[model samples]
Target: MSDYICNWDHCKFEGTKNLAIRHVIITHAPPEKVPYFCTLCSFRATNLKAFERHLTTFRQHILLEKENSQTKEYLQISTESYNVTWGNRNCDLTLKNEKYLYPEPNIVPVLLEINEDYTVYNETIIESTASQTEENNENIEKLKTKHKREMNNLAEYIIRLEKKLSARDQEIFELKRELRCNEPFIQGFNEMWEDQVRDKKEQRDRKREDWRRGKVAKENMEPLGETFSSPPSKKMKSLVKKLF
Candidate 1:
């Protein structure tokens, strides 16, 4: 660290190098004098690095200093710039120049007129902004309501679809159960049909055998009748008599 000059002029207080540096940064660099203002608290800093640190501290102090006049004004300025960049740009030169060279003839009168114009414009803007804000809020509320309705409809549709799917699944499950229950009956019916067919074939075979036996008996009877009807031969008869 380097030796630092006491920010207070005519003060013979020689401090340690670090202490002197801190004093210069806290007192001289602060916004009370200029050339090294802290961006945060607007306090003057002796060095750029110190100003940067002060800015950080100022950010930390934002919530605490929110009600502070200086802090509130700064915040308002920042907010105003954010709201309307074009207007802010147009006013930038006036704000910077008004602080310097105040009593000059042309500049002073022009500055006053410009300030008056800015005030009038700002008032008009505020009035219009209030109405616009109300309209925007109404639109936002309507949008939120519509979104909620749509979400509810979607949820209901999903629930209905789930119920339908459950019903379909139950139907499928029942069909499977019925198929299982009928499997044994179907098998038994097939077995019975086969048995009936076998029985029919056996009956047909028995009828054919009976028809063949009747045909053979008729043929034998005819031959026996013809033989019996014809008389015995004379020689056969004579030989029969001698043997008796």
Candidate 2:
């Protein structure tokens, strides 16, 4: 990575070797044919295409640097002279001796200022108008798209909820109908249980009465048997013998 040096005056510029070479080709060379030497880098371009391509990339940098320096420093422009220095030692160019070399304009210092208020205002207004218009258009499109999607989703949700609610109502109705159908069977079971309890109680009462009567008869028979087996009393025995 060699540092970039402007070929114009051998002054070093802040760039890579490749960029420097590109700058040289684009800024100084002719379109169809290569220049014998580069105006900025002093490196020669063999073909015009390479030169044009180099200039296209380097031109922006050159213009920006010139614009920045034009305020603080003066530019040395000479139509008569091929070699001229621009803004200190950063940029220098040498042109071939041609009719365009000694053109009408000579090197002069330019004073920079922001004097035109109306032009600035007009430019600002135009830029603001364009930006606002673009933003509004974008917002409107987004809103329309978003509204359509939300409406669709809401419609689907409502339909699904309605289906769920209907199913629930149907289940409740079926449960109520089942309860009503079972009412008669439940009443019949209650009646049969009451009848069975009444019959059992009556049978138990009859058995208890028969046991009491048998106990009384057994007591009376024991006394009669004992008397028949016993001897008679003394007085009674005498009476009985006389009678016999």
Candidate 3:
């Protein structure tokens, strides 16, 4: 057998060329026919955005290079290109990358406290404080809304199914009713057919009996003119001789 090898790193699948091609086509390529190959890993996506997400969010290659957290060091903050970190380690930023105009860390507050009709901001912590409480509430509300919507949709679907089932059942009932109504007519037809067969049999038997009786009578009958006692003549003698 010819060797068909998958060149993707960490992949152990080896087969014939056709099998390897089939496996790649089925596993890596999407049905939409777009090719999105991952630069770092064996993962393939259907579109560029999906490939980018796979590169940043699901960084299988980046995580492979990540050392154990026992070693601690200050990592620089990159501003030129946005990148998601690999592990659960924090990086102390001394200077931002050249992408951002501001030297200080870009701060965007997620949640604002309304104090006497004025929005208050906490300057110390950059990013959203909403991650502490509001995020969970929002998630819970979204889940509830989604669940309710799904339930309503399911209920509507069930109602449609029930309606169809009811209509089908009604149609079946009507067919059964029609069959029941025709039962008497079917029975009458069967009885008429049986009666006709019986009558024909009786007529055939009567004919056979009549024929047998006529044959017996004919066999028992005397010769022609035997019952008439006439004078002994040459003509009668000749007729008797001929009949005998």
Runs of candidate 1 exceeding 4 Å displacement = 1-124, 187-244
Candidate with the greatest TM-score versus the true structure: 1
lDDT of 2: 0.47
- Tell me the TM-score of model 3: 0.27
Residue-level lDDT of model 1, residues 67-100, one tens digit each, is: 4343443321211111101112222111221222
Candidate 1 displacement at residue 235 in angstroms: 34
In model 2, the clashing pairs are 7-41, 8-40, 26-54, 26-55, 27-55, 79-101
User: Candidate 3 lDDT (Cα, whole model)?
Assistant: 0.46
How high is each candidate's TM-score?
Answer: 0.31, 0.27, 0.27
Model 1: weakest 10-residue lDDT segment is 112-121
**Residue-level lDDT tens digits of model 2 in 67-165:** 432232222122221222333333332222111221222342232221111110111114554566567667877998999999999999999999999
lDDT score of residue 14 within candidate 2 = 35
User: Relative to the unseen true structure, what is the C-alpha lDDT of residue 239 in candidate 2, on a scale of 0 to 100?
Assistant: 98
Clashes of each: 9, 6, 0
Sort every candidate by lDDT, greatest first: 2, 3, 1
